[model samples]
Target: MRRTSLLAATGALLLSAAPAAAAQPQVRIHDIQGTTRVSPLVGKHVADVPGVVTGVRASGASRGFWFQDPNPDNDPRTSEGLFVYTGDKDPAVAVGDAVTVSGVVSEYYPLSSGETPETTANQSVTELTGASWQVTGKGSVPAEEIGPDTVPQAYAAPDGNIEKTQLDPARYALDYFESREGMVLRVDDARVVGPTDTHRSLWVTTKPEQNRNPRGGTTYTGYADANSGRLKVESLAGGDFPAADVGDRLRGGTEGPLDYSSYGGYVLEANALGQHVPGGLKPETTRKQADGELSVATYNVENLAPSNDPAKFQRLAEGVVRGLAAPDIVAVEEVQDNSGPEDDGVVDASQTLTKLTDAIAAAGGPHYQWRQINPQNDADGGQPGGNIRVAFLFNPNRVSFMDKPGGDATTPVRPVADGGHAALSTSPGRIAPTDDAWKDSRKPLVGQFEFRGAPVFVVADHFASKGGDQPMHGRFQPPTRSSEEQRTAQSRLVRGFVDDLRRVDGGARAVVLGDLNDFGFSPALAPLTDGGALTDLATTLPPAERYSYVYEGNSQQLDHTLVTPGVRADYDIVHLNAEFHDQTSDHDPQVTRIQP
Candidate 1:
């Protein structure tokens, strides 16, 4: 908690016992780690700064060692530890080795591939570069416990940019983590929020009760409640990272130096790995629709292709047959063409749809027929040349698809009055296919279907993905979701189309469903459900069960299904893929049983 203001001068130090050097105050780790995020002593050289080695990252582009001063300052705003960056060169230091280091202080930012340090909303890691250290003696690196009380309720400054803000460990969690950068810390019996990843890492939250879902993981409901108690863990070199699923417990605990990384803002490079305790979490299956209930479901199959592993196709089919209970109409998104990711001109997905239906039949589900308007080759924003599109799979014996002609990739179908009722000009048509709102994105696939001799309009949509948006946890607080702009426009366009249907016939039975690629509460989503033209059925679920996708340890809803106000429907978000580590797709399919 100690704080010190260094000499106002900003230049190279003599690094010698000269009269000029004598005038400068003695340097400490806290002095370099100033009250603010940017180091006050940056660009200045210091010699004989004393500390003990707490950890060493021997590999990677950021090869370095962390050291902490045994004598700490009382100012909680300043940290007592620092990272000595020996980029590409080995420090050859071990834990518990008391050391005096000499180097130039600087700020380091881990940039993504192709990102330059010139301009960004990213934060910097204060470190000592061009450094040399000598082992003075043996000492212990202190480890602080991060219990429930350690994290503050506030996530960060309201403005989101906490870069120049002074450290307030007692208030904002981001400031608290930034204050302890490069310091040893410990967490006990941490609960897994984000599941284990292929990178040998997982996210665990210290405060287990903060946003608990019935399934044992934290939920991300909005921008304000970010679940700040979350922290990342990784085992030391040559050790296996613990494997755990959502709601699983990190038995015992993990201890190590808290380092910053590009993968996540902060990381605990674990010297002692935590044991994984399973939480008995399993995929959930929904009850099938009763007779006369025309069930419609939406599932983002995660870029499925005919060339993918047969197992994946089979699992997806199993999910549709059993997990979703074989809904009468399934709106499938991300159905890649036969070539998958190959950058060829193949845009036909008949092979892909055929493989899926065959698998569904093999899994003992209904023999389903598919309908879709294929997008232009490589025009849709997905895997190159895959030309992914939203499609429909219907049990022809139960519900029949109307056969109106003239549907194509670039053709926009208009809403027409069919015998005093609302109907699509074509059985399968693309909505505003050439509009800029859907540029390089999947167009909404609108189709007309019949059940019990009554016609119904269905709009299957896969809005733009949130790819180019800034990271929510990045230095830019409440980071800008620029990608949402497109989706918002997409929502408004689809909403207008839905309203057109409602105007055509006051009692038009319409179901709008697919991977909207947005949260139910998002600004983009609000328009779709605005004016009561359509009801976001996903919102009817218990708050804890609303999520359909999991990203960065935050269980959130990115897919949705909506229906006209006059339609009576029962909705269920079948929790099958997201909660489980083993999955057929990243998105959970939602089904709505609508009455005829």
Candidate 2:
């Protein structure tokens, strides 16, 4: 769980400072794991701690064994189980053997190898290091059962420093988990809320009735509504982890040691797995646009490039063509260049676009033409050298791109008065390319198009991603969203530019669409819809079908499409990729049919 292996930097230091062979304190496991979240006996020497071995991990990069005291102290604030980190050596222990352990107690704040407690906002894993054990006899401790009714409804207490707070298992969920940090827990008929990943892990909800969406997942509406009943499950003994989709049931029961890691927080390293029962989750497709309507869609074809596998292009093309029913215009994000990710200064994406469009044509869709402005070499901040940018793809027979020649990487696109309406100074141009709000981020591309002989200005945007922000389950309550500052500034820039377009013509048809990377109700989304210049279409969906992305079992929205008053739009967030196991991209593409 630490940044390094079991022999953590802090643990190695504590091991060297072990006390002499003097009489050590005879303490119980509950006294070591006090009422507070942090152990009071940290960095102290303990002798002859009694426990029974419940699980052993003698093989892997993380090798450890878990033991639990057979008798509980009748206090909910203390746990009986303990994990013995053997560093790289194997511990000769069995599941039922009783042992007396003598070692130094240390706190390894998993994942913050170089960070001290004052510098990091992460919880620590209290373990006994530099340990030697003696086999006493045979014993067993039945694992404590965790169920839907047992988990607290309150997610977090909003306390300032959670590490010093007393355990309140009757109130908050975070405290309940902390009270039983290294204990063995069991779940029966656990419902899968998040799909299995490549690292042999999946998420299951203890409370099935909380915030459940129509797609068999939990819905994350705002910051305070985080569902904390979700628990991560992984195999402990390198056995195969069970694979299941959303709503699938892990029938029978699954029992294991409740270990903590930096990746998923508290995890159930299962020694006995449950049977996987399929929930029959399926992908959803939307209907095609009507004859007199223009369809516009936004998709994040995840880091697509020519060097990617053919199946990647084909699958994404199939989603655009078949799942979305072939929208007339598509604003694609993360379109990498020909020499994808190779820092050779090659920034052209003609080959990548051509391949995608060809695959769409082969999938029985219309012939599409693409337009894009390549960014300066490594100017955008995606992968190190994968010059990812936003681009447009339009069906030539249905809509025509107004081609102008003055657009480049650094020039800002302008609006000009033409025939009592607004027109772009350069078609397929970047909006405020030199603005500080868009520094090292993908610039918004504004394209002018004519659908059914009417002027339509489309602004394609891929705003700053949500990196560098603290996790929802971090030590800080109501996690800090520092990344939203850049997105809010970028939204204001887009709002100002759209206002300029409307000033020229009060009835300007502007469709702003792409991966916005912020929630629909966030402060960052207010600027785009605050002044009435545009109406956010993401709010038009029902509560059950609102999200376009799923993260850690919470379905949420990140991609969006907004429209000015001149265009009458009907929005549909196609639920193809986000909910299913077979995903071409991590996001679900959304389309809007407009009648101008």
Please tell me which predicted candidate would have the highest lDDT against the true structure.
Answer: 2
Q: Give candidate 1's whole-model lDDT.
A: 0.85
What are the models' TM-scores? 0.94, 0.93
Which window of 10 residues has the lowest lDDT sum in candidate 1?
1-10
Stretches of candidate 1 above 4 Å error?
A: 1-23
460-510 per-residue lDDT for model 1 (tens digits): 999998877776656777788898899999988898888888788888888
Residue 24 lDDT, candidate 2, scale 0-100:
51
Query: What clash pairs does model 2 have?
Result: none
Over 1-596, each residue of candidate 2 has an lDDT whose tens digit, in order, gives 22233455466568669975665566877877888767899998787799999888888756778888887898998877788888777777888899888677877776555666666666777788887777799998887888888879787778766777888988988778878877889999988888887677888888888788887888778777778788888887675566677878899788888887777678888888789999988878898899999999999999999989999988888899888999999999999989989989999999999999999999889889999999999988898789999999999999999999999999999999998989999998998999999988999999999988888999999999987776676677767889999999999999998999999998889999899998887998789999677998878777656788877877888999999986899899988887666678889999999975
Off by over 4 Å in 2: 1-25, 112-118
